[model samples]
Target: MEMQKEPVGDLQLHQVLRMNEGDGDNSYSNNSLLQKKVILKAKPILQETIVQLYSKSFPECITMADMGCSSGPNTFLPIWEVLEAIDESSRKLNRKPPILQVFLNDLPGNDFNSIFRSLPSFHKKLEEEMGGEFGPCFIAAMPGNFYRRLFPPRSLHFVHSSYTLQWFSEVLEIPLNKGNIYLAKTSPPGVHKAYLNQYEKDFTAFLRSRSEEMIPGGCMVLTIYGRDENSDSSAKHSPTIWDFFGMMLNDMELEVTTPENHKLSM
Candidate 1:
């Protein structure tokens, strides 16, 4: 029997997730001025667009899903923002907010305890804010990978994923004896090709699954990391918080796990 490949260690994975702090990292909060202008600015616009689409296409829709939701204070902010917009728009149509069914999805290893701990407060705030007129809010947790499938067929009205999807299942291959950092800088062609290959595969699967599970004309809003206009084609890695975590991995002497044998369950 073939031995199964060990899963990527959490510490190393965390590094990759937080690597955006390095110099030249446009993902840094300091870079937030510009990043905020181009990327952060697009979020509200996209949410509004989604709300408008829903109002026109399915004004009664209240079932939403936040895919790749990590547990934290930040996780629910965007969802709340979008919902608020939707609620306001519904008000214009003399319609009450539809009974909301929210599904929060993440990997099996995600910090669900923290998520549940924060949920009651989230619900309470919404209820109090809406007073007695609020529609029923049903929030449930769905633990699984996002690269495959997450929702019941034809169930969701709105789907959202933010700041995820830049992650590949594993580190890209670097030339031997060139050192990780050097290979990452000089061998741009190979690294980007690898990243794009994985992105296309994962992204295609993501869209396909969502298409199957979403009602026809249901809206989707996704916010992801991408290269700037000036990014050099030869640079092996883009700057982001995940790169900060990668630096930490180097300091801790951790090896990045390869992606070949690891089957991600979306």
Candidate 2:
């Protein structure tokens, strides 16, 4: 895996930052249990929404996209859940299940090749699991920043995003959040303000871009990375797995900068 560089100039995070790729132990595919849980938790909402959409319009084909679909087994989780829901609905309503046109979207730096390579197996599994009664699925990749428009205007019928919205397109170069990596209790007021400003700006852009791309009556579901609404901001911002990761990074930095280590390097 390539080391992530701290943003130095005008370069955006989307241009440089990439998720751990390939199916190695350290790769995102092997270590995204948290994200997997999030996706499954939102299953009910996705099912209900799909059922409603199908009831309203008996379209021959349904076009949907899953933003931030990193490579691995989880890559097809949304597709499976969606097709299953539609199949159930179709059986109940005595209607034909619409064929799916899936767009899996992420940053250009994402592991799109790995996803493409597994397409054969994925299609085979879908066919085996669902059998001939199910409609076919056509999947394609859309590698780009979701904060910008990714699809043609008024083309997509549904959008699903899990654990993606909180990541800003560009890293802020503000000289703040020094002691901590993220907005923690130690983060000063200025640091907090800067992060909040960036969050608002990025989220607004995301909404605007998606709104323009989705067709009329289209719906979306997102699992945003955020603190609990009931939590007190004055207190610690509530701990996440990334907080422990920040601790490990800080320890590594201290080790690298110790007098013995620094002098030996010199």
Candidate 3:
């Protein structure tokens, strides 16, 4: 696999950020309802795209990828949805479904083991759900940042991502904004420009990389958080959330510096 650059500026995201793993309360498996909802909403698009793909040309096998496929029960939802789309189209067309080759891509640190553990259930569910109608299905993991090349040219026919690209490759080393973990309405124009530049670069890289890997006529369905149409680029959804965080931090700093707290520490 070709080495990819950090998704956030120079910061290596694979090292620092990952969905919480395992079956604990914090695990992505348990807490990914919103992500799942995004995937569910994309189903109609997926179905339409697959139908068009079949109409144009029927490949012997369908190459599908779920980029940023974090380790969790939710990881295989895209695979299942895509397969269902293909199956439905095949039925409509009175044609046999194509073999399904799925690539689950995520950062190297993602809990692939958890995903692997869930594979048996995934397979069993597919069999029970589709039986002989479903063609041979092969699922594999590609551990790398999607901002870089992860597959060979013309290797994929479909790609999907949900609620992932909003994260930049890294945090800006220079804190342009005074008291925000992410872009906020209070951020200056320069800070906003810096973030927009990072986003454009990262999103461009993501598209370029995918273009190299996907065949002509391939389809990509992705969901990302965006500012409201009426809102400016700097106006993120949670403007006050960060300000509250900043206030809490300031209070903690004052508490630590107080005479009573200082004396107790000494």
**Each model's number of backbone clashes?**
17, 0, 3
Q: For this target, which candidate reaches the highest TM-score against the unseen true structure?
A: 2
- Estimated TM-score for each candidate: 0.70, 0.89, 0.88
lDDT of 3 by residue, 1-266 (tens): 11122336344556767888798998888988988888888878877887788778988898989889997767887788778878888888888889988999888778899888888888898899998667989999998889999999989999888888987776654335665555667666776787788899999999999999999899898888786636554445543656787768767777988999989998
Give the per-residue lDDT digits (tens) of candidate 2, residues 51-97.
Answer: 88888887889999999998998998888889988889999998878
Candidate lDDT scores, in order, read 0.65, 0.85, 0.81
Worst 10 residues of 1 by lDDT: 174-183
Clashing residue pairs, backbone N/CA/C < 3 A, model 3: 7-169, 8-169, 8-170
Cα lDDT tens digits, model 1, 1-266, are: 11123657744654345323322545233343442343346667766866677577655547888886666555566667766776777787777777777788876666666667778898889878866686767778887667777777998888877777766555444324222442245344665465567778878888898999988778888888776535665554556554565566575553333353234422
**Model 1 TM-score, 2 decimals:** 0.70
* CA lDDT for candidate 1: 0.65
Model 2 / residue 33 / CA error / Å: 0.9
